[model samples]
Target: MATPVLDKVEAESAASPYITVTMRIRRFNPEVSDAVVWEDFQIEIDPKERVLDALHKIKWDVDGTLTFRRSCAHGICGSDAMRINGKNRLACKTLIKDINPEKPITVEAIKGLTVLKDLVVDMEPFFQAYRDVMPFLVTKGNEPTRERLQTAEDRERFDDTTKCILCAACTSSCPVFWNDGQYFGPAAIVNAHRFIFDSRDEAGEQRLEILNDKDGVWRCRTTFNCTDACPRGIEVTKAIQEVKRALITRRF
Candidate 1:
């Protein structure tokens, strides 16, 4: 039995699919220096593993000082959003094999926000924009004894917008947001859309009015970068267009 176990271990070792890949990371530590620098680390990892796994390897084995935010390793938490290979993506969802591993993979923090540390950015401004849109379903009058009812068609009206995980990938990818931090961004608009089209929500007019601000929906340039960056495959640009149409016609 001991010999069989040893043989199995040897066979697994021989079948290892590890490859040497260089992870190019943008390093910034305000406590140490204001200047941002790019550092490269050569790591041995399986291509099928996630980029987050590489970061963990570098932080655990190479440099313990590496700092970034992550809650659930799964993509649902939306905490590990970052720039991978010049595009915004969830680190855990991006597989190393999917991106070209022959070249150095670049990792950095999302743009248009204050960088707190390596791969970490201040999300207060992002959240403030989200709050401005009033993402929660707003109702008037007394509380209902039962849940608000809606037709299947009514629910489908805003189903696409409801998939938003608030990852900020769609927002951070926008060039308008990159230049102007005041822009409410695609994620905020998508959240507003979720409530605006809901049949049971009575605050559609109010949310639309809020989004009609100078820094609101008009800032979108329709570059489709938001749609391309969304990991959830949400039609972000279309939703923005729908909001624009609603604004003009005053109809939901």
Candidate 2:
């Protein structure tokens, strides 16, 4: 006969939702091989755990060589953005149970950027596009008298785009970005929208001129993929459209 404690432990174990999930990751290492390969990792984890937790297990216990980027696992850092099961998302923000662990979860580096390793990509190009948009407050005067001021109405105009963390999820999901790397992707336009609509920003016209270039805001296809891929719940495509409208009408 089993003891009471043993019976209770057995019952709890039986009710546990732990499952063996297969993570199919697309790997690439120019130093190791020129060809990209898909590697599968079978991990035993709780259904409610995060995908990042599975990756941690794989790296800690299964294979130390499994590479990926993550910081501030709470998702604020935006360093862990990647494609999971055909959709771009932050690995730390994605839950295993929500993504259906029964089937293999496919993970890969975000598209458009050149992959440096298993899941890391070269972000210099993305940052270059961001810098090209002049994503900053450009006031035409000396130091502000007492910090630029704005009314609630003015702040609300560009509040939606201010939540961007520069994860590159929206940019990599863009079809236009994938086809033509030169196209200023949705992330850049979204950042531009934040400052372009600001009542205190004086360089809105200059920024608009930069976006009016051939590979700028006009390249957006409005497929809404960037909006869907944003982990911050930002209406990304909407911001891009606002930028386009501002360029055409010269009104923020």
lDDT of 2 at 174: 93
Candidate 2 structure lDDT: 0.92
Q: How well does candidate 1 score on lDDT at residue 149? A: 86
Q: Name the TM-score of candidate 1.
A: 0.93
**Per-residue lDDT of 1-252 in model 2, one digit per residue for the tens?**
999999999998889678999999999988899999999999999978898999899999998988899989998999999999999999998999999898999999999999899999999999999999898888886886687888999999999999999999999999999996999899899999999999999899899899999999998888999999999999998998888888777643
CA lDDT, every prediction? 0.94, 0.92
Question: Model 1: clashing residue pairs?
Answer: none
Clash pairs of candidate 2?
A: none
Query: Please, what is the TM-score per model?
Result: 0.93, 0.93
| Decoy 2 TM-score against native | 0.93
For residues 53-115, could you state the per-residue lDDT of candidate 1 as single tens digits? Answer: 999999999999899888898899899999999999999999999999999999999988899
Name model 1 segments beyond 4 Å from true.
1-14
